[model samples]
Target: TQLLEQSPQFLSIQEGENLTVYCNSSSVFSSLQWYRQEPGEGPVLLVTVVTGGEVKKLKRLTFQFGDARKDSSLHITAAQPGDTGLYLCAGIGNTGTASKLTFGTGTRLQVTL
Candidate 1:
């Protein structure tokens, strides 16, 4: 199992700013996923990177996986107030079950106007 670590536990920024969040692990993962959560709701998956050095972009967000499969990053361009939420990264060692995922602590982003 991989243990995930996220950087910048808390972030506060203005609209139109750009930010990057990181997730690192010592162990390799079969797949890694990024998620965003609102105050009162569960996390929603943003993107899943299964291949090493893979990058996936969603609108203004970009997700990248490390070539060694031990790390990942998320970059947001031109932040928006509506993007405020708790971002999470989850590493999966195997595809067996939902219980096998190791989740990062999380990065709380507050984008202000």
Candidate 2:
């Protein structure tokens, strides 16, 4: 069974703090993607890495795909109140519908101003 699980289901931090969230699974994935969504809004794609050991960065946010393709991580260098949101990782399965994406449990981050 392929599934993505996120750590620290909840996080509360002051402004300008650094944090990292992990996504792990025992099954391999064709592609791994990260997304962030604000309250009452849909998730917005942040980055997608198809190759193993791939690293992508978006400003203060960094993402890494495991060499085994079974895990991923998101590192935030410095977070602000504007960075507060739900961070999610999605694994695109090799089988099943092409557009199917299995999402992680999600990590709600609160950056206090």
Candidate that scores best on lDDT: 1
* Candidate 1 wrong stretches, greater than 4 Å: 95-99
What are the RMSDs of all candidates, in order? 1.5, 1.0
lDDT of each: 0.94, 0.93
Q: Report lDDT (Cα) of residue 45, candidate 1.
A: 93
Q: Model 1, range 45-106, lDDT digits (tens) per residue?
A: 99999999999999999999999999999999999999999999998885566646689999
Off by over 4 Å in 2: none
lDDT of 2 by residue, 1-113 (tens): 67789998999999989999999999999898999999899999999989999998899999999999999999998799988999999999888777688899999999997
Clashing residue pairs in candidate 2 (N, C-alpha, C atoms within 3 angstroms): none
As a whole number from 0 to 100, the lDDT of residue 69 in candidate 2 is 95
